[model samples]
Target: MDDVAKGQNLDDFLINLADGLSRAQSRLNRYPVMNAVGQQSMVYHIPRLEFELKLQMTAAETPASSGSGGRLPLQKKSRVQFLPVKASQHQSSSSATSIIKGVFVATPLDATVSQVRLSLSVEKKAARKAQVNVAVIAAPGRSVQGATVELNIDRELSERLNKTPLKPSTRLEQASLILNQESVASAGLIIANQEPEGQIIALIADLFGQTQTLLYRFEQG
Candidate 1:
């Protein structure tokens, strides 16, 4: 920044920097945020407005559209800084030793990027309501009591923490229960079933300050 503001007075530079920081803060304040899941992988929602604008810009920059004036660049960018997930925090009930922090990336469907494969076979409780079951093991050789589970059919599973005693209307989206080897926690909720690939299912198990999260792509039958 100092290089870019060459020859500028120190006082003027400080004022400009402060103004820029303030604008950034204001932008963050305008966007709705879900930070309860900060313990695990942080999930951020790039405003739909930005997502849509990005699409328009992509179209404008394409080879066929070069003759037309390109879309103006956006001043701000949204990013997700993926932190290294510590193994001790996430325990997976499925393939116990197979994944770290309960989240695993499946092999690539094509040749380039790896992704988690979407799955189906959910037992439907009613129209638009799909039932999901998850087994949680907070600790080994210990009573899995006092553990709670939260889940929902969201575009991003790790979006937020669902509170217990959720409006009866949304009871199935989140639930609490004693977890154990023989016990399973389940959540059922009415859904849009939007994408062609399937909806994402996120389940979180929290006990004694330990958290386990699973991000699964769920396909509708």
Candidate 2:
């Protein structure tokens, strides 16, 4: 009887163990099974370079000519250089800015002058190239007492100014200025160049009757 009882207990234990394993398997089956397909990952990127063109303008003092009995010619000095800027995803195009500083000499005939204006033109070679003029001052300010002025250039704005035709006389008279006593003045400008590598020539004029040109060369990145 002891042997028989032992046998019966062993059978019961085996049956319980089998039932527990079946239950566990069933629970696992209820949960979703995931399989790894051919593993794949993808990424896309675009590279670009950022650059800036800086221009500075100042008054050029010519030496007194011996023939003119110590009289000097009024000339201006200008310079341009390129500056590398950090790349940004938001900036898609290259741009330029000019900072101009100078002095205005007043004469006896400049009493009627009450305002001053500044204009900019972008050229390629010797021909006038139409570019976007972001800020072209048709009439800058009523005070011609010699102060700072700013101009801007871009593709969109230049197209508009090109469409509006002006006579040669009007264009020539654009930056004429009357003499004033104040010697301190300043100006600024911004421009955009679409080409990746080339030369850009900029001509700037002020109502103070002075004009200056700047040249720049660029290379591919």
Candidate 3:
């Protein structure tokens, strides 16, 4: 049963039990034939019942709003971080695998991120020709599952990244990467096995223009 229903039922039970105990006590007091020992035992039991009743009443009266006690204020910014994955190992291979397996992204429980974009580079050169794939997976805490969003890069920008060299100081705006807020909030990027050895940069931006970046490097194991 739901919490509210359970609480109501408990309240009714306690009330009935209390009324029955009171009636029994009154009957014992009115009957002079009852031995003093029985009366004393009844008195002791009364206090214990009262204590239990008080406990239950207190619990029932407690506010249900306490469920949100652990939640922080919505205005607070949450820190975002990348979950680490074990480096891939290959035997009889001359080069370390650049493919990153199982990439997981995380945000604060109340994060307000609206957009997410990824930048990739190898040997300081833009890896625009490389395709980055991602799959959305469960995040920590009570976040909803199966929410997947896809990011779409425009052809002009894709062509630019493929042709032009990427500068270390390049801003995300300069790259003209367009990110859908809904998709970024629910999805993560996946780099397949064919990706080049480089640094994968994740740029997450909130609605307020505040941005956070997580960088992952793929090297030969």
Give the clashing pairs for model 3: 96-220, 114-181, 133-190, 134-190
Over all chains combined, what TM-score does candidate 2 have? Answer: 0.19
**lDDT computed for candidate 3:** 0.32
Candidate 3 residue-wise lDDT, 18-53, digit = tens = 677766654343222324432112222233343222
Q: Candidate 2 lDDT (Cα, whole model)?
A: 0.31
Q: List, in order, the clash count of every candidate structure.
A: 0, 5, 4
Question: Which digits, one per residue and each the tens of the lDDT, describe model 1 over residues 87-204?
Answer: 4545333212211121122222353322211112346665556676665442244444444443333323323333221222333455555444454655565555342334344444
What lDDT does each candidate get?
Answer: 0.38, 0.31, 0.32
Models sorted by TM-score, best on top = 1, 2, 3
lDDT of 1 at 120: 20
Better of 1 and 2 by TM-score: 1
Off by over 4 Å in 2: 1-146, 150-193, 219-221
Tell how far residue 85 is off in model 2, in angstroms: 63
TM-score of each: 0.30, 0.19, 0.18
Clashes of 1: 0
Which of 1 and 3 is ahead in TM-score? 1
Runs in model 3 deviating more than 4 A are: 1-186, 219-221
lDDT of 2 at 116: 34
